[model samples]
Target: MGRSPCCEKDGLKKGPWMPEEDQKLLAYIEQHGHGCWRSLPAKAGLQRCRKSCCLRDRQVKNSLAS
Candidate 1:
């Protein structure tokens, strides 16, 4: 299998996530859950890609649940 197209830079945001991005993602997941990771970024209005969002979810989710 090959890497996802979403993984490419594609001019998407990179580096550390801003507070607003984390808030938006958390809020969206709280309201609707992360049904489709591939489309979650756009729906949540985040500049990150799917993988970034996935990683963010893990980071935030783990920290919160711990």
Candidate 2:
């Protein structure tokens, strides 16, 4: 059988991120630079999986640079 989807496994959150979640991620990334997307959510106290974090990082990275 095919492996289960990562988002569906382990009860990891899936869907739009909350404002507080974004703020938490932004602050974490700003302070720690998101060294590894795969390991970032736990470090940042997020319920989302790494892919969600990765996408959010992409969205904010450019703005953060400005």
lDDT of each: 0.89, 0.86
For residue 23, model 1's alpha carbon misses the true position, in angstroms, by 0.3
Model 1 lDDT tens row, 14-65: 8898999999999999999879998899999987889889999999989989
Where is model 1 poorest over a 10-residue stretch in terms of lDDT? 2-11
lDDT of 2 by residue, 1-66 (tens): 998766885768888878899999989988998699888999999999888888888887777788
Q: For this target, which candidate reaches the highest lDDT against the unseen true structure?
A: 1
Pairs of colliding residues, candidate 1:
none
